[model samples]
Target: MNVLSHADSALSLLPPVVAILLAIFTRRVLLSLGVGILLGALLLTQFSLGDTSLFLVDTVKGLVWDDGALNSWNLQILGFLVMLGMITALITVSGASRAFAEWAKNRIRNKRDAKLMTVFLGCVVFIDDYFNSLVVGSISKPITDRYYISRAKLAYLLDSTAAPICVISPVSSWGAYIIALIGGILTAHGFTESGHLSVFVQMIPMNFYAIFAMLLLLCVAIWGLDVGPMRQHELKAQKGELFDESKGLPPGANADLPEADTGKIIGLFLPILALIAATLYFMISSGADVLAADGNAFSVLGAFENTEVSQSLFYGSIVGFIVTLGLAFAQKLSMELIIKGITAGARSMLPAIYILLFAWSIAGVIGQLETGKYMASLVTGAIPFALLPAVLFILAGITAFSTGTSWGTFGIMLPIAADMAMGSDSTMMLPMLSAVLAGAVFGDHCSPISDTTILSSTGASCHHIDHVITQLPYALIVALISIVGYVVLGYTASVMAGFMACCAVFAVSVVGLKYYAR
Candidate 1:
């Protein structure tokens, strides 16, 4: 069971991706992560040094100590830390976060409305998961408490919509990431004759997971057909469930969220605006000069050629932090209070900071082992030629589910799709590549291990595991339909047919589930 035999599977496409996935859903994230890391390390050690145990120890020690792949990921983790600090400082200084909560409490006439409103708010603020979680959870907690909505239900709604909307919306953080990745895939696949197209014309339509996630959210909102962990939580909420966990005091926790702090929210707004403007500028420039890799907007965040998504957030967040201070000074709020707020926000992000490091460390190890290429190769080798597209969807799902990382899977699969397009008929390339993107996103969206899941839980003040459990079934059902859509499209090579089929499934599933479950 602990064997790392697939060490030299020469798999870059399909098979090993599933291995990563299997390790992920084995339930305990830390345990699953350790298992995957150990497995890969052992196999690598065996392949290179002929000592499995030595490899395991070295990988761990290297990760904890050495200046290698792990170091690069740490660099990214630092960005996450900075971004969080900025978010906290901005929220507290402006008082807008607290104002939003107060405003929500004042608006609520009853508990049910409060709970429903929480869900409504989660949808309205659809730009970033961090903002959504911090603002929505902070504002909704007291409101949900008043209405008897349990912590779990609040988290469920928060987690459900947080990344779901971003993935679909053209203007949000998800859009920037996906578009950039799509540009690369297009370039590799020769979607454009010369270089990677910065603007993805067709890929957006094929992003099935994000699309179906939105549909799933719509269904949950309209039908309220809660089931499994979610339904159990809903009942507990109805019964006035309560738990006193004393989850640490993050800075944002100090203020009621989404409140109209003319200063704080405004502070928050300036940086966000800066980020959006920056992203648009970068994307446009990249699109204009498709052949230039350096032209990609993501690559030029704070310093030149720094496309790290977190850096963009960090730069904008720095602006936000400054705005918070400026606004506080203008309001005559003591420097002491501003410092206190920043400290609190950083504290709240401590867990995220740690998780980011660990996730990166693991990814670092996987990268060293060429895990993506290995898995992609394995899957491609084993896949029946006729079922390559179907397998792509499945592998993408498995990869996302295992790593709680749709982005990581996207990085892996997009290249594979490009490579695949070269070997196959040009017509077959786009549809299959689109399926890969969609499936990877679908898997990550619902995974408990997903960062998105964590954000959702924090946003709704829901228990971390509870959010994962509640949202899983719905994600699976949609995944099933996505698989079906890919299959239909695989045979016909028709995006429209696949799109229509998915819509049809959503319609029937919603109606049938509502009728039958009722």
Candidate 2:
């Protein structure tokens, strides 16, 4: 807190680089994040141990307790994580997951069907990445496991689809946040020809990364296109080693959980359906209430823009938890067993919660160090007109990868992207903005510290490192294709041309991958 005058200098790059590299090589997420946090605090405090200590303490304290009050947003999200864990445990212990798997096995033929089902669910639950990541994994896992699909593959399916779908869908939390930002940028730059929502819709075809990533994931699921580390995981899974036991089980996975043979499929479907309904209701109601307070009409888009997503998820989880408990009582599970299951389930989430806490802490320190600002500053110069979109895509990817938050990257880079486009080529504004969106999602997909990535791993009950490593190759493939797409869009100034280029590249990549895989 004492300060570094050159906070936005190259020195700001140290923490994230060190953290990310250490996480990849050592596969120790907590230690890597802790080191990053410590380094950032020291740098921010100019290496004063006392100041660094205070900064570290205050950083974490601020997450849960800010300004002498509980921080509603962060606390609510944490509550949701815990409640989700408890519900998951109850479902497993009561054998609801097993029951559902048994019920589905008759209709679903093989791994391809299971994988496709996962993709379908991932697409359907596009409201929030956090929700999509966890719920889809839980629903798909039992089915996937039945077909000898690796948890890492299930995680890949979850991670690859969640952000891309949310980023593209207008009704999603990510879309709302982004549209609001685009609105501000448009207003500031005096672009009144089109509304923010319209611009966002137009940019959908231009979001090359999001569009292509989903396409590639579907191909992978249908064709069994396993590559790199993912192939190793899949092979091991086929040999009856679903995951390396030595690396430890993922969050919310307890091998000791009891499986009741009498568990009914209704027990599984009811609680999950209830959770989704409750979450949707709360989300709409919360957003509507905010709109009404501000004397605005009740519009779905307006409601989403004002909705408190964390609050809604937390409330929905509470309803889900109650439903789960009622189902357990109806199943006649013993009181002691139920209590034990709840404790175990909550305890399973402790690891994820701890990692998230540290991740958030380091993100705060990174912000104070102006890491994103430093990254953004490097692109503030004369750039080639035809390369601006592709360049912004790369820059945004790097910034989001380093900062571990796509939203943060959007806040820091979107305005810069807008100004650059306006000054250089006003016609390229939409494509440029779309590149930033694509790049942010690309970076978020690769970052080990990203919350969506972590939740994806937790949801699939796979080792966090396995999820990161397995998905990295797939992410890189789509990102490269997206870069090509952006470059084409920049040169041709046609969204269709860019999308076609992406499709051609993707088709070739898939064919090449299939041959290589064989």
Candidate 3:
């Protein structure tokens, strides 16, 4: 049956709103999501008890087994997660992480250097946010812990850099997804003069939230600008209390495996390098297949534009896992121990997997109800042209924050923003589009229900709620600067001037908070 046929207007928004409110108040993510799903199903069935029951059944079926059997994109994602878990487990069990941490301990020297190293590593893995967060968190946690850096801070660094970096990096999976979305909308509207890639390139500078977030991360790393709950966490960390033991920690908290007598850094470096290389290879090859199917000539950018990123990630993880397994065997690790490590690692990720399923289901339900279209209708004709970018930014942020999915927000907002821009001065289109992207990232960064947030905590072995609480202030600071930047750009139509103003504001805010905000 067609799910998108139903459009419930403002009522369509209740599911996500209920989900977010319940999560914040109750701090029970799974229960909140379950209630939200039931509410959505009831709404979808128009409160018919029999249909609602069937809808819930179908929802579980769809999430667990694509349509009927366990297959499709959901399965691919699950496979990737399992492989990643195994790889992380193997690295830790083999003492590769400890080996690398020991090697870096001599050189890193201080807490600031350790934090900066985490940021550097996060930025380097721009291929995918999931990969970035998990890998960086696992690799850096040992070193950060050694330097008495809080797990909350490490989580913040992991999260802030993951989505923000991917969104801005031209060659990333996020960039490819965005270009395709823009291209589809523009193609349908018969507006293809500059091409989607060219437009996306132009919009890069206008991605103020991402630019500002990376800048703030740098400042936090270099100058030790900690404020809000983060500052308290840092203070506690300085007293050798990295995390409150009274509060429950997520799985993989003690990820630093016992050191092997002959452990080498090669165990850690090889799998990571393999994962990156394999993912790139798979992305290009997968894209090439799509291009050939469409009878188009081969080109790196063109192929990437058509690549199946999820599938590529799945394949890459598999390769990485195999390489790690080989290394474990080569090191003469017992088969039983290797299997145990893999199981342990995969078990740690089970919570994240369940959360993802619920998040995806809610997103699907929201799409079915046309919540995005309904929200878009509210703002499409109400705003003045000059303030459109800022309005869209806020709307996108709210949508993403409520739904906990940036891609869903993009799917809902980008077309509407593009159509609105078509009627106004053409110069504003790029900025408005940029605003949607920036706002989505901002919201995702802040939302506790966001998958990246969950993964970041899992990676750092921090309490999930603690990570959410500590990271919110930092995300808000950048968001505030981005909103002001968009407002100024709306009037001046000069990206450079607006960017400089935002940077200055950020710098001043940092200095003020550093000296006076205690």
Question: What does the lDDT come to for candidate 3?
Answer: 0.83
Q: Model 1: runs farther than 4 Å from truth? A: 1-43, 46-98, 105-190, 193-199, 239-308, 326-340, 381-386, 418-424, 515-518
TM-score leader: 2
Q: Would you estimate the TM-scores of all the predictions?
A: 0.74, 0.98, 0.94
Error of 3 at 219 (Å): 0.9
Ranking by TM-score: 2, 3, 1
RMSD of 1: 6.0
* Candidate 1: tens digits of C-alpha lDDT, residues 1-518: 13343435553222234334553455334545555555555555554545766666665566446654454434543554555555554555556545544655667777557656766877777656655665567556656766666666666667666766666555555655666676666655556663322244455676566677766776675567777777777776676554324534322233332333354335544544554455345434434344355453333211212234444444545554565566667766666666666666666666555554445545555565555555566575655454667788888776676555777887888777767756765676766777777777667766655666666665554555556667778888888778777777777778788788888888888887688557
Each model's lDDT: 0.60, 0.90, 0.83
Best by lDDT: 2
Candidate 3: the clashing residue pairs are: none
User: Per-residue CA lDDT of candidate 3, range 310-404, in tens?
Assistant: 79889999999999999999999888778788888888778778877888888777777777777767785667787888899888998888778
Clashing pairs in model 2, backbone N/Cα/C closer than 3 A: none
